[model samples]
Target: MATRPSSLESGRIHHQLGKPRGLLVSPICTSRKMSSKGPCRRGHSSSDSPCVENATLVPTSVRTHSENSSLIASSIGATEVVSQQPISSNVENLAVSRMEAIGQSLSARGISQQVSSVILSSWRHGTNAQFNSAWNRWSRWCVQRQVDPVRAPLADILEFLHILFQQGLQYRTINVYRSAISSAHVPVEGAPVGQHSLVSRFFKGIFNIRPPQPKYCTTWDTGKVLRYILSLPRNRELSLRLMTLKTAMLVALVTAGRCSSLIALDLQFMQKTKTAFVFTLVKPTKCSAASKTAKKVTLTHYPPDSKLCVVKALEVYLQRTKPARGQGKDKLTSLFLSFVKPVHAVVSATIARWLRTIMASSGIDVSHYRAHSTRGAATSAAARAGVSTAQILKAADWSSESTFTRFYRRDVTTSEFQTAVLASVKR
Candidate 1:
């Protein structure tokens, strides 16, 4: 009689046969025949037994340890085998289960499960984090008050918004919480929680009391930053740290891109031309995700200023970091890698910190302005340089001219009105 192979031996056999690690093969169960009732027999649940009809191979990684153990036990009396199912169907089923779980947690009953899943799928990871945070806060409040958060009365929601306002939360933050509640709760009196009459009135009152304000009224001078960058040692002479900073700041200024876009720049999608370096963002940016369009950032050679040219700085930096990409299978292909050992791709937050470092080194007040101010500073400088509004809009990826005018446009120079008034009334 032939002896049965252990699980380890089966794994070795599969490996020797060049089978993919993702695929798992198990011997068929021939100890018991299928009963007349169903595919599974008595004393063996369907989930616990591998019947002839359900003996198809699935990825071991997707199954729990106990399930795999059961499969190994059932394969002890084996003869025939079955082919594998496509992995795509299992992955799809996993995604559907997750969506259903989300729908149940959110108490999303106003829409069908399918529609709710699709709606939830549209939210980005960052949006999900924000929504979850807000929901957790709401849930805590309901627990303290002994009310159901998902089915809470309008009075409870209004009281919660009132408490948030009293806590000195800004209108924008409170509005986010309101939107989060609306997402989880069913409509109240035929209107979303945010749009209900009393809730709308309360929000309007809050807005009137504490209006939203632009973060920066005037942006730092771009020439100051460029001059500082140019004053640094030559690209080849500078240390890897300085070169990385210089390259990042130059790209940030010329492209007027957000940190998200900067970090999403992959070498695989980059195109170098005689006049410019063109990067098509393979990943979706905040604006691109909303507009359903791809974003392209082009950095053209600056002939007038060789030292401050983004293209030259980027080329030198890339060459400097080439050896740092690692050897063998561990090599990295990201546009920006960490300067430290075991270097890997940098995150968006790291790029933001690099921008802030450049700003501080260039004499800009880092306390008053955030890393995001780079967008406003660069765009405002372009507008001052007589660049057309259309070009500015296109470069900044803004869908409307009003977006630039309302949010990003700022005085890059000293306030002319204040200077004129002070000069006329000399002390």
Candidate 2:
């Protein structure tokens, strides 16, 4: 009983006020997948057609539902306006468009995880922190090994650990790798894979996998180190070399400086007043810790280099050799080469090779000794020099190990602990 715009009644319009009737005339509304570009304005559409940003914004208040057909109609420009759609299809398209917009706002940035963490931490502090350079190296390593650090799996890393062990890497080194990936994800129940971190999840029982301990190093005693040096093949300049080796070994054994610091030795650090060398054991400008303060930032561990053995040996080495270049660097320094390639600067490998040569010469059998053996030797010697294990721990900067006490135990003297038996005979 209700109708509008019929050919049978040219001049009259019919309206049944409350009757449900079958008079249908509505434009079909359709649902289209959202374009990758974005939602379009009223004049524009959610079609693949490009959105014109210059177009006026649509007032979002306008909308209507159709009862006659699957098309929604509303009044615009004082005339009937209709939307094309299958009703469900139109709703689906709107849902997808809104979803995509939300996602782009929440997805991960391309920055590395470490870098992102640094940024977040820095922001909390209201200043930027230096990003770690080690991450770059590790990332390059991952790429070379065909592992995606962003998505590194536990299996890939387990195999990587095996490779490291096979390549003569010590447990300490492998442990460093474990630390690189040590961070675990805080899992949320039923969360998406990429949505949450996988770090903590990957190593669910990682602690159960005991990192291989390095060879228990009880063999780097002074006698062993000395014996190794002496076993090296004797040359015509055997006396000179023996003196040098003994002195170097003595300093290394006493000081335990890092390779860089040991190689970086100079007369400037020699404190004649204190009768010791003030060795700055810290690596130069290589760590973020350098910002702490000048002397406080640098690690200075003094070894008794003033002893006649160290001094005389150094004096001899200085007097005997002249460098082909690097005169400026070497002019006032005679402790270690100040420059190389026409000057003198001692190198890490050279130290290692010399130790190897001396070890071969000295006929010592120290399996767990390398360049770091000097550190072991110095700690051991300190233990024997009447220093308490606690004091040695501080002196050696070795608070990190469970075995530092073990390493620093000198022989316990029973006689030193003996008490007099003055009152025991009366009974």
Candidate 2 Cα outliers beyond 4 Å, as residue runs:
1-174, 178-204, 224-244, 273-276, 280-288, 291-308, 322-326, 329-335, 338-343, 366-368, 400-403, 406-427
Model 2 Cα lDDT, one tens digit per residue, 321-344: 544323574464535442234445
lDDT of 1 by residue, 17-77 (tens): 1211121111111113223443222232223211111010111223322332222122111
Write down the worst ten-residue block by lDDT for model 2.
71-80
lDDT of each: 0.62, 0.35
Q: How much does candidate 2 score in TM-score?
A: 0.46
Best by lDDT: 1
- Residue pairs clashing in model 1 are none
How does candidate 2 score on lDDT? 0.35
Q: Which ten residues in a row have the lowest lDDT in candidate 1?
A: 6-15
Best by TM-score: 1
